[model samples]
Target chain A: MIEKTLKGKPAYWIWLAILGALIAIGWACYFRQYAFGLGLTGMSRDVSWGLYISQFTFLVGVAAGGLMLVLPYYIHNYKAFARITILGEFLAISALVMCLMFIMADLGQPLRGLNVIFFPTPHSMLFWDMCVLWGYLLLNVLCGWVILTAERKQVPPPKWIYIFVAISIPFAVSIHTVTAMLYCGLPGRHFWLSAIIAPRFLASAFAAGPSLILIACLVMRKYADFDAGKEAISKLTTIIMYAVIINTFFFLLEFFVGYYSEVPGHIHSLQYLFFGLEHNGEVYNNLVPFMWVATLFNFTGLGILAYMKIFKVFDYRLVGTAAVLIFLALWTDKGLGFVFAGFVPNPLEEVTEYIPTLNELGITIGVWATGFFLLTLLYKIAIGVEHEVEQ
Target chain B: MMDNKRRKFLKMAGATVLAGISAPAIVKLSSTDAVASGGGQEAAAGGHSQSAAGASSARIRLGMVVDMRVFYQDQALLDVAIEACVKAHNIPEIPDRKSEIKWIWKTGYENAFPEHSHNHRSQILEHNQFAVLCNHCDNPSCVKACPTKATFVVEKNGIVAMDFHRCIGCRFCMAACPFGARSFNWQDPRPFIKRYNPDFPTRMRGVVEKCNFCGERLALGLEPACVEACKGTGALVFGDLNDADSEIRKVLDEEFTIQRKPSAGTIPSVFYIV
Candidate 1:
């Protein structure tokens, strides 16, 4: 089973080598951060949380998005999804690895990381988030490993694997909900306190997760002589189309409530994100550009997906392009827009902008590389098992 | 006259440390508390430990009432108070505004009372610089956010305390504090501490810290260093809120007082008299 991932073309090894170099550089940069302090990053007294935390928030959605496929195939018994369910599960395992890595990179004291567990605080949302994340990661690892191994042996998976599958269905939803709760429960941060934050997270997760998988499936089809079938691809495109609509609708609802309610606490962050908030006669709207770009991408991606669904067109390239657009839009909206909105015009009605330094960016890229490295291996093994068993 | 008293107080604290009357676990081999300055937060005399003996009665809710009129009249009074606190606690003087650590700070009405600053307000209120520090809330959001119990409210004294060694420096507390009270040591703080107070310890990098309501001073049967510095000014008052006859309670009852972000439901122990 392990040998499948080891045997690859020169292009594959070259890609791995590049990632290996990035991982090495990222770790080297992290060591410098550890020796110095978080001062190496662009975060400050007002904008306390920056790139690492925002990235953690976005990737949690990506990990939770894997459940869209798992729930449909296992519970609803959607046969069209059977060909790609393994892809979703493997993607989850890879994304969770990145999620955990980003969290470690953000910690001020990574060595005392166990303190969260050593002093298990049930009252804290972080305590619950840690519990749910590890639980979700373990469940996906078990489900993916067992299902794929069983497929290669040409036998049915253990009857008990469904119980884990059943648990993971809710686990997927729980991870994003718990992650949102981390921000929402803080009374001071008005931007994160929405009742629909968890739902918004799930919507974006559904959109982003499948978008990446759709693009990955297309890549696998071209590079590895593997086809996930036309029906499965079309079904996934429709799922992404609906997810994008829901995600965009959720954003519009936030916009309506922020402006219509006319609450300064509620509107300040949104104002800062979209148009820039004025503080002390200086307009502190650094996030304005990225946020506007996200808004454009979201509506444009939404328009394209809606048009495709209505026309009943599923050309691989057209759908692939839409998926890329939707994925980037959600990533920026949450990663760039949401987290900064929470901190700008900080508690004191003062603005302190955050811009990640090169060192922080290096560590971030390293963490992402590690995640992709895991992903490439998992996908390779899953596909190899499929090829060996299908023959 | 006050300078002599401050020197005497520092000498006594130094003498106590030299005599080694405290538990060996005290952060500094001197009786300095961990939260006050240095390491071994879970060890004795780290602010939360019962070793802070005389004031360990759980019934007492410590509180402060700020009379802004005194500071408004003589701004130097406020400056002296801030200097006293920074010196006693060894707060780093980081040049970068973002990374600077503060136990107490001054802000105008626009920042001090963000909710009330919009409309045409009092010129007097607008001019006076309000002193802000940790609210040490009765129901603190930071206590709930900390992944590790590094920061917790001491039930006995009703004071929020930090264990520097235990803090993983996640900065969740910074976000949880509505008043922007907490500061993270972004760089090694040792270099920035200009005047080392042997009576207190200095913290390392990568930990969150803020005003402890002078818990270490209270342990030594002295008022907080800031209160002591402002003794004659009538600007800053510290007393046990639970005590019916305490000065803070009387001040609160008589004056029109306010707390930062009352709607956040933190129930700040610190109050301001407009």
Candidate 2:
């Protein structure tokens, strides 16, 4: 079951070591969750969700973000995407794996998760979200794998797969949108109750997720020789810029609604998140200010990409810097109180705060490292396929 | 002294076991097969809708009316009423602090409604006393938000009922409800349930629970435990909202009464005369 080497150096061992360390960390932290229960996390009765769920939400969006790439490549016949569309699909599979892992970690009784499917309640957004994310995960993996295998063998891919990829675009959007509905539908929770939440979620996903893919492409080009060509790279950057614009626009609308409405419930959480209101006490501390800086970094990064003449070469340093910022900015905004801002000052006017504990932080790191390890392995096999390496 | 104390404890324990073993058989032998229905005249159509009952009554409207002004005078009475109801309903007392599971209790003046306060601590009177359990709204949003029909408004009498078996503990109902009526059970209930009440349904962990207006008691034509325990002034009144001749209707007609958070547009079945 084991494959030995890349370039005969047993590079797979390096990947195995990294993955093993992550799994060990995951096991150690998991024991704490079992012993202490959910109390170990920052979640309280008022703030039912925290960083773990937020990351799951963001990661699902990223998995769907691949649709923006997949659609143009398959449906519209964009030749530029042809070289690296398999990479996008591979990225999506990894994103889906991370999304599921986060969901599993968030549950109080991990064994009970099967109940969501067994007793399917159509009225619950979570039920739909569970179904859609799972469906999208399967479609992308199967279709992407089949197509990649065919390409490796110098054979024609089954014509039906194009239809599957085509079907996956809107289906992918549905996966993230349903996840958004889980929050947006609540009436009193001002932050999440927005009508624009589903759209905003999709927009952010497109920007954050593909931006990740573009970063991954750039990374591969540097360390390995999977150079998908400058033309393709330029095209991906262009798409990333456009997605970022959508993401920026979505934020603008969200901010406009928050400030203009003047409803204390709606406005207070956003204020608490950004301005550090109420003596900058317990919950709203260092990270609240970072939201503003995140907006700036995202805009500035998008601006650099938009103004093509400024950076003629598409320098790796500039790309990496901008990508890292956009990634962090979105992560902070989505994965923290930005999504939670709506829920504070609950209908009862009780302020329950959320701050991820050491155990929660450790569990999150373990999950992330596991995701990267799986991603590294998948990409290795894929690039090996493209290069016609022997099995 | 230690030997005497141990003997005393053993004697008490022996008596408790003797009572426990004989008490059930005595009751079963004495009582007939008939289910006890306390004497209350039913309307021609019965209390609740037959479709909802699937067995017993027709459409029934369950409701409550509390005289808040009078409630402010008594803390001991309120505690007794809540304790009685908790015992009758088999509700647990799990003490995680955060997940405070309460089927019925006093919400003193300030804590009951913060927006309506005239002074800093208007909710708490000279002593702790205020609004009683859930209002059980006519258009209960909690019912609307519950993905499973776990939490529902029984159509006949409009009692908000929770089917614990179906509940997934998503807490969406908690967020959607304006009254903050619902409570989540963070831990299992078995450890905390001190006594068994055959009339009321017991809850599981993670599912939401709240005041059910003592639907089981009302079904048997008995007043809710809270109503029976309120004593002297009789501050708590359980009745059929649809009946114009009921005491609840009389209070609504004569007194300048109000429902909690009326602006919420939930049209609460519970009313209060301050």
Candidates' TM-scores? Answer: 0.94, 0.82
Give the C-alpha miss distance for residue B20 in model 1, angstroms: 19
Q: What is the DockQ of candidate 1?
A: 0.74
Error of 2 at A5 (Å): 9.0
- DockQ for all models: 0.74, 0.22
Top model number, lDDT: 1
Give the range of the ten consecutive residues with the poorest summed lDDT in model 2 chain A: A1-10
Q: What tens-digit string does per-residue lDDT give for candidate 2 at A185-210?
A: 76556677778888888877877877
lDDT of 1 by residue, A222-297 (tens): 8877799998888887888788888878888988998999988889998988898887788988888888888788
Model 1 C-alpha lDDT per residue in residues B136-186, reported as the tens digit of each score: 899999988998878887655578888788888889899888999999999
Q: Which stretches of candidate 1 lie over 4 Å from their true place?
A: B1-58
Name model 2 segments beyond 4 Å from true. Answer: A1-12, A277-287, A307-313, A389-391, B1-57, B85-96, B105-135, B188-205, B216-222, B231-234, B256-267
Fnat for each model = 0.80, 0.19
Candidate 2 residue B242 C-alpha distance from true site, Å: 3.1
lDDT of each: 0.84, 0.68
By summed lDDT, the worst window of 10 consecutive residues in model 2 chain B runs over B34-43
- Predicted complex 2: CAPRI docking category: incorrect
Docking class of 1: medium
